[model samples]
Target: MNARTADKLATGMFWAGALTVIALLLFLIGYILYHGAKVIDWHFLTSPPTNIAAGGGIGPQIFNSFYLLVLSMLITVPIGLLAGIYMAEYAKNGPLVKIIRTCIETLASLPSIVVGLFGLIIFVNMTGWGYSILAGAFALSVINLPFIVRVTEESITGVQKEYKEGSLALGATKWQTIVKVLLPTAFPGLITGFVISAGRIFGEAAALLYTAGMSSPNLNFSRWLPTYPTSPFNPFRPGETLAVHIWKVNSESLIPDVRAVADGSAAVLIIVVLLFNILARWIGRRMQKRMG
Candidate 1:
């Protein structure tokens, strides 16, 4: 084919592929929302699930999901960011750096089931935490830490050198330049990383299966103290997240409304993940505009 014809064909092919992907995503989301919308109500969302009866809600599961997410993020964010910053700015390109990168890549490529087993061994068994929210959060950290670290490092390093030069020229120290200039400029990518991590944390079931347990206790939201056994904020309490609940309902739940419960929980999980993405993007844009 002539050059112009070849270029036109490639462009058409690219457009076709992009449209196919968009169509598939829309169809999947629409299918889930359509089915799940029928059963999602305040009662379903706020009441504890029934063992063998119908009309069970996933109240404790929802609470556990969010609580575990917050806990994992709280643990993951600072450690990941600091490690990424150190890797991007302070680490020398040497043997140690090479080994560290290798390890990170290895961790990122590990299977979720393997991570779950590891968590079962260390966080649950060795630590004697015994299938609790804290154990689950630590497990999620293992799953999410590599992604966040890699993303943060790449985002910061991807910033234009001009910003760093300008900051340094303006009498800013190295740390100040990075903190004030590079991170803000890289906010969008950082936010993307966070959203991706949040989605993974929300949807993860394998790692949490052994760590978080498969049953949530009767949570007492009125209990304000974290030390309380039934308190929502108690990290030591066994918490079955929405993802795990869905899995259990689909696989082995004897409840009569198993299908409805699973569908509703899946829908809520998807909605929450979408909200996290949208809110993170909005916050990132606002921060970037202010920094700019």
Candidate 2:
């Protein structure tokens, strides 16, 4: 083929592939929303689920999902940030550093089900925490940590070298320059990574199934004390999240409206993930504007 004709053919093929992907994504989202729309409502979101009843809601599961997201992020972000900073700023090129990076990559590539089994052994069996929120959060932290660390390292290193040099030339200490200049400059990317990781927490099931259990006890929303066993704030309590609820309903639930419940739960999970993505973009834009 002529060079010009070959180039045009390749360009057309790439456009076709891109359009196909977009179409498929739109169709998937539309399908889920359509199937679940009839079952989703305020009552469905606020009422507790029933074991064998026809009509039940996912209120506690929703609560557990958010609670676990918050708790896991609380544990994951700080440690990931420190590790990333160390890798980006202080770590030297050596065998140990290479080995550590290899380990992180391996951990990141682990299947969710395998992570669940690891959580079951360490968090549930060894720690004596049973299937509780704390165990789930720690398990999730393991899944999230490598991604966050990589993102943080990349974001910090992506900052312009001039900024660091300028700060240091102005007599700023290494720590001060990092805290003030590097982090703020990388804030947008970091937030994007954080939101993406947080969204994963909502969709996770296998790991949480073993660590957080398949059942959520009746929660006392009125009890604000974290120490209270029945309180939603109590991290020691068993908490089944929305993703787990969906799996349970579809696979083994005895409820008469199992299909409807599963559909609605899946829809809600998709919506929450969409919201997190939207929020990430918005925050990233705002941060970019401020930096500009």
Candidate 3:
């Protein structure tokens, strides 16, 4: 066969694969949205679920999901960034560096279920935290840490060496150069990694199932203190996130509309994740322009 013929065949195959992927994605998304449209309304979103009610909402579970995301990210981002800075900046090629990288890779490769079990053992049992929000957040942080560290290290190291040199030449300290120039330039990438991590956190059920309990008490938004069962600030409380709620409803619910509830919750979760990704991308682009 002629080279031109082979090239055309390869090109056709690539386009065919791309189109197939797009079609599958559209079909899956459409199917979910259509099934969920009748059940997802403001009332469904803002009201708490009822065990006997035909049309129950997922308010508390939704709250728990966002709470988990925030709590986990709060713990993950700073620690990850610091480790990344060390890896990219100060850590020289040596035994310690090798060990650190090895550990990070091992952690990254670990299954989320393993991390969840670890959290269950340490954060839940060892610390007497039980199946609580904090335990779940810790589990998520473990699952997320390696990715954040890798992203941060890459973003920092990817900054052109010349930028650092120029900053140093212009009388900036190494620290100053990293904080002012490198970090700003890397902000977009860091945001991307963080948001993608958040998206994963939102969809996680297995990890949370083993960490955060499948039920939460009626949270009193009025009681903002840590000791109150209803207090949002009480990390020690067990809470069911949206993903876990969906799994629970599908697997164990006796409610007649359990399927509808699960579908609606799943759709909401998917939409939120999608919106988050889109928003992250937009923010990253804006930040990139600003940095430029």
Judging by lDDT against the true structure, name the best candidate: 2
The alpha-carbon lDDT assigned to residue 44 of candidate 2 equals 90
> Which scores higher on TM-score, 1 or 3?
3
The candidate that wins on TM-score is 2
| CA RMSD per model (angstroms) | 1.7, 1.2, 1.3
Alpha carbon deviation, residue 25, candidate 1 (Å): 1.0
Give the runs in model 3 whose Cα sits over 4 Å from its true position: none
What does candidate 1 score on TM?
Answer: 0.94
Residue pairs whose backbone atoms clash in candidate 3: 220-230
What is candidate 1's local distance difference test score? 0.90
Clashing residue pairs, backbone N/CA/C < 3 A, model 1: none
Model 2 TM-score, 2 decimals: 0.97
List candidate 1 stretches off by more than 4 Å: 51-55
lDDT of 1 by residue, 51-153 (tens): 3256489888988998999999999999999999999999998999999999899989999889999999999999998999999999999889999999999
Q: Can you rank all candidates by TM-score, best first?
A: 2, 3, 1
lDDT of 1 at 175: 94
Residues 1-292 of candidate 2 have per-residue lDDT tens digits of: 9999999999999999999999999999999999999889888998998632555899999999999999999999999999999999999999989998998999999998899999999999899989999999999999999999999999999999999999999999999999999999999999999999999999999999899999988888899999988999999889999999898888896788788888898899999999999998899899988987
Clashes found in each candidate (C-alpha, N, C closer than 3 A): 0, 0, 1
The runs of at least 3 residues in candidate 2 whose Cα sits more than 4 Å from the true structure, single-residue gaps closed, are 51-53
